[model samples]
Target: MSSISAHGLGGADDLPISGSLAIVGGTAALAISFVVLLLAWRQPRFGRAGHELAVPPPIARVLDGSWFRAGLRVMGIAFLAFMLWPALLGRNDLANPLLGVTYAWLWVGLVPLSLLFGPALRAMSPVRTLAELLDKGTGRSGGEGVVPYPAALGYWPAAIGLLTFVWLELISPSSTDVGVVRLWFAFYLAAMLLGWAVFGTTWIGRADPFEVYSTLVGRLSLWSRSASGRLVLVSPLRNLSRLRPEPGLVAVVAVLLGSTAYDSWSSSATWIRYVQSNEVDVTRLGTALMVVIILVVGTTFAVASMTTAVDTRRSARKELPRRLAHSLVPIIVGYMIAHYLTFLVEYGQQTLIQMSDPVGSGANLFGTADMEVNYWLSQNPTVLASIKVLAIVVGHVLGVMAAHDRAISLLPRRHHVVGQLALLAAMVGYTFMGLYLLFGS
Candidate 1:
């Protein structure tokens, strides 16, 4: 199998913006936004659960209808079938649709899909659909399995799953090999099904890497459900504030941010030269570096979060990181868009074209084989760079606002502003680093 670039795009030199200018401007935007938030946003404005505008009845009914949900499941099943065709029978080369579908469409395309529509993957997960079907076939309620899901496992399995996936996509030398990709999916399907059989549908929520990632990003979307199970529209920030602090939450966010950052860093000329010159195994070194980057991100955020003086009677200092972890979702989404925009837009179309002839037999089953990918985004480097910087800056600004609101709600009034200093600094640091990677890499 031929290798494919994980991010199908040109290098930083192709970008029209000056690296130093973008970095400094992005950093200044974050700092200024933080100061503005500190002054203008004094009160705790979010974290009000059930605060949302009710959707129109017709729209709500359509969204909540059984038929609508079943249609989504059907689409999910069809999508899975389409993907499997390439994985199971297609060429073991980059021409296979499976490679682009797995890396670009599903991985990067998920961000925008979830952002526009809430938790699209969860609604469309073939594994969950199959598990549900199995439960029904056995006269089970789909909630209770052989054993209850352990609350302490909260997102830990998903964290590990996500880390493993990124390692394969970003570090593994054979990531594009059709055999390897097929095995990876086989293992994922087996593990998810087993987990569901043992712990019920809850396993999919807490353990499925793609589902968990999508759900987290979905929290930043305007779509949400109310306490009464009605579909409602809510401010993304307020919706994010409702995210419950759970075990392994910090680790999940860390893996996401760190993996994306590492993706950018690994693509740089500096890293490439180092890898070429060293006699060390590239896979081993890449894995180690990815892990270290993840650790550093988690550790720094945890430390920054707990540096504030907290009211011991109300909130435990140790739990602050997890409680505040929701704020990072915006940043993660922003970085994902900036990092994967070109790849998703360009390669996603290519994947669609490839899907038309999954087995390379010249069959136009999907009628897209004759279509060509539009490289508008890549062709306009200035527009692309502007979007990247804007996404990163806007995400950081929203994150700052979210963090401030959480801080005011949690910290003593006397120490509110002071309490957020370290966290703000850390956020600024993250923004700077992210921009540098975008520009430098």
Candidate 2:
């Protein structure tokens, strides 16, 4: 099988702004935001601030109706079948829709979907639907299994699952091969099903990577559930602050941020030349480097979160990282948009076209076989670069605010401003590195 080409609009030379300017601007934005937040925003104002607006009864009724939910579940299953036709029997070349669907639509497209809608995958997971059906057939409760889920497990399983997916996506030799992609999903489905049988629907929320990812990103969305289980619109910051700190939350965010960074780095000329010059196996080396990058990201954030002076009696230093992990969601979403915007726009269209002929029979079943992918984003490199920079800066600012609120709430009154200095520095470093990778790569 031919290697899949890296996706991007253009090289660093093609960017309108100089790399130095972008990095400096991004760093300045982060520093300024930190200072403004430190001085102007002294009190903790999220999580329990009650900024939510109840949805109208008519809209809420439709949204929470059983029929609507069932339709979504059916749609999810039908879409799964549509993609499986190509993965299981279509041509083994790039023409296959499987590769594009997996990489472009499902992976990259999920971010925006989650941001617009709340935990889209959790609402329409085919695996969860199937589990529920099986449980009903067995005369058992929908989310109940043979045993209760252990609280100690937390999000560790989801973190490991996410790491495995990134490894397959970024380092596997046959990542785009039809058979390999099919096999990977097969194992994923089997594991999810088996886990559901053992631990019930709770397993899906805690172990399914895509669901966990969507849930994390969905915190930024306006849609949220109220205390009475009704859907309501709330401030994104408040919704984000409601994320409960759990074990391995830091690791999950680390894998997301680190893998994206490695994706940018691996596409750079430096990494490509290094791989070509050495006699080492590219897969093994890439895998090791990816793991190291993830570890470094997690370690840096963990150390930074714990570096501040805190009253040990009030807040445990070791738990600070997980508590602050919600801030990284915005950063991850920002980098994802920067890295995958063109890819999603271009390849996503291409995938739609290919889906019209899933079996390679030259059938335009969906009348999209002849559609051409528009390269508008790629054609305008400067505009694309500007959007990327803006996204990074805005995300950095939001993250700064989130961190500041959490830090102040966790620390003593006197240490509020001082306790955030280390975290602020770490966030600045992240922004600088993100800009560097964006422009340099």
Candidate 3:
């Protein structure tokens, strides 16, 4: 069987270090906790039940109507169109400008949205929605509830996706790979839909990793103070606003930011050739990167949970373990910053290409033909690529801090919004810069 078929989901051959790190960190924490429990066994304490994790709230009453649902349907069709675009018109005459917009919307745009909204994509998630439709058509409910709410799916799928994402970064990290990547995504979408066909969203939610993280974070956050200043931990940390960041976090974030700085200065031609060559199996590299990312992020979740647990026990007037469990959030956060920063760097160039020659792109049903505004803005002295690096750091801070209970409320809006706007603004600026380089009067 081919590598893709064998792996099913890419990144099956993940590096052992990731798992080792998780196990080692978890085991160490467990051991330390065990020792502490033994030491404090005789202390008189109130019996508090072991806390259960909290999941993201269900989609509250939508202020809008089926419009949101319709949009999801449109996205599904658009994704299908993008997958078939290259086949319809051979690569030579392909309308890149149009394709660029579609790619941007699906990736850059959707990423921040997903991160900020706690699996917001799941609501109108093209993949899930498509899966639901297919399940209905096939007369299969997949065994249970609708769309397996995030709580049901747990965190495995996301861990898989994160791992896959890292693998892609190391391997075919090119805009051209969009066609293949989109196709891969569609396949996963099909699988998810099939999952619904077999089990439904309710079941999937129980399996979603993000939901699991959310549950864990929310429950532990109960020690987190509420907006009213009382010990209400059900919600997020309201005061957890993004700060200037600690030095260690800054260093890690710098590495991530610096990755983009280097990429922006490199020729995309060089990077593309490296990936397509014999040295790298486009599939293998993709898988490896994905696993690497998941490990890093998963480790972060582990550390954060430990931190919350420590804080929670202390708040409850219990003798808590003093060990610094998995104090690796800085490293993990730094890597996440690097992963995302690299994407933005490459996107800067793609946006530029579209802005320089919109009409040379030909006509498309999507109206992405003349989206040169971004490229035009990129040329302005004020709209520096450096700003994008800064945004990465800011976004990381937002993502991490918002995970806390008392701090989450202060932000009000989801942190992902900040990242999304930063990316969009950067794209606009870069596109405009490219336009000037190509056709400045």
| lDDT of the structure predicted as candidate 3 | 0.35
Native-to-model Cα distance after best TM-score fit, residue 405 in candidate 1, in Å: 0.8
**What's the best-to-worst order under lDDT?**
1, 2, 3
Query: lDDT scores for all predictions?
Result: 0.87, 0.87, 0.35
| Model 3 TM-score, 2 decimals | 0.46
Candidates' RMSD to native: 1.9, 1.7, 15.5
**Candidate 2 lDDT trough over 10 residues, lowest sum:** 1-10
Which tens-of-lDDT digit does each residue in 1-441 have in candidate 3?
A: 011101111110122233234323333443344334334433312112222233223432231247765786678667556545543443422244334443344433443443344334445545555556666776765645444444323344644543343234333545345455556556655655556654576534433323322322222222333334333223222212212122122222222322222222222334447766758665555445434433443343333333333124544212111111112222223223323333333453454444344444444445443443333322332333233323433333333333322222212333423322322232233222222211121
Residue pairs in steric clash, candidate 2?
A: none
User: 154, model 3: CA deviation in Å?
Assistant: 2.1
Highest TM-score among the candidates is held by which one?
2
Which stretches of candidate 1 lie above 4 Å from their native place? 1-3, 6-17, 49-51, 312-315
Residue-pair clashes per candidate: 0, 0, 67
1-441 in candidate 2: lDDT tens per residue? 112454783565665768788889889989988888877988889956567899999999999999999999999999998888888889999889899888888888899999999799888989888888988988887688789989889899989999888889889988878999899889889988899889898898999999999999999999998887889999888999999999889999999999999998898888889888989899988888999989988998988899774756435788889999999999999999988888888888888898899989999999999988888888898888888888888888899889988888888888887788888888998899888888865
